[model samples]
Target: MLTLSRRFAAVAFSALALVACGAAGDGAGTSGANPSEANADGELGHVLGQADAPLTIIEYASPTCPACKYFHDTVKPTIEEKYISTGKVKFVFREYPLNEIDVAAYAMARCAGDDKFFDVLDDLFENQEGIRYAAQNGVVKTTLGAIGQRHGIADTATFEACLSNSEIRQALADTYATSEKWGVEGTPTFIIDGVKHNFQGEYTTAEGFSKQIDAKLAELGAQ
Candidate 1:
């Protein structure tokens, strides 16, 4: 049995090459390859809304982070409805797993294929508490496998294969490196048009965050 830690240990703080910001995964099974794909910033990760939307918000988040969950469950939907749906913003979510368990959970999401990427992420965020419980009870993979099954991962056998997949592991490591290069210090960090935007203090609420984005759109002379 490959203990979860040893399974994903190759990518933890060991300095891996960046994946050149496109194709959610290089090759292998997870996310596969799509060379011509890219976002408004010409960087690649899972994206929502128009590809050329003027505002591109890159979010660095962890699976287990409660704040990350809040943003996903609450803040994101509001932003999506107001900005992303209107072609004013391009949203990119990059995995910034803070622990070995988070890495495993994220790897399973990637394994579900790019087409199902966001679905898996949504499910993981929705069931984050259950996942934490499973991890505590020594049934993390089984829990993750169940989640994967709902997102086209097939069965436990296939689930296990992708969970321990070398390519997915490497891609995540590359994401980790890329996050460092971009100076991401915490989960839920947002970068708009190549600049980090902190939504703390008075900017914490949905209405508050929207005001900041609204100001940015105004500055850019809204399309």
Candidate 2:
């Protein structure tokens, strides 16, 4: 059971997940700062694995996207195990939230900082259904506060404060501007070496992702 604070963080993170998809990816680069830095200030959009690795894979996703979670929980981990974990590749997660609710989720996650960003991310994806139910029934905000508490953000006041900040909203907008630059029209799109590949659903599987990765690696000739 996530405390309110954790839920808040999860929701914020989830919003960022969607925003990640919308963040800049055009050849002209992104706004504010490059997402590669540690203190990206939620401006990193979404990212994964190592940063300096040879191969860089950027994924644009939404929190409410079931397929996004499937890729995160199943497909992504497999890629991490075989490629990212070994330093053969690095991955970036970007937000591309489709609506206002999704935007709210990203705000909550930003409250927790980048350190807890991905951890809370996994939890949100794993419990997406439960969160949606709570939101639909009007208990979503409370549940999110509980989530914050579990994450050591026991200060409800602080959590709420973060959620309502104007800065977060600006960051969200920047994320969208960035996404549009990247030309994202859907979730789970992959950008490998700046070339975008939109998966037609099947890439959510481990084997399917692996095969595509292999193709990319082969194209690069492993060096």
Residue 149 local lDDT, model 2: 63
Off by over 4 Å in 1: 5-42
The true-versus-predicted C-alpha distance at residue 57 of model 2, in Å, is 0.9
Candidate 2 lDDT by residue in tens digits, 1-223: 1223234334433433322333323332222223343233333565556666767777777776765776787678788889988877877776677555556566677777778777667766777777777766667766666666666566878777767789877776776666554556767677666656664434657897788778777877863
Candidate RMSDs in order: 9.4, 7.7
The 10-residue segment of model 1 with minimum total lDDT is 29-38
lDDT values for all models: 0.70, 0.63
lDDT value, residue 85 of candidate 2: 86
lDDT, candidate 2, equals 0.63
TM agreement with the true structure for every prediction? 0.80, 0.75
Please, what's the RMSD in Å of model 1? 9.4
Poorest lDDT segment (10 consecutive residues) of candidate 2 = 26-35
Error of 1 at 169 (Å): 1.7
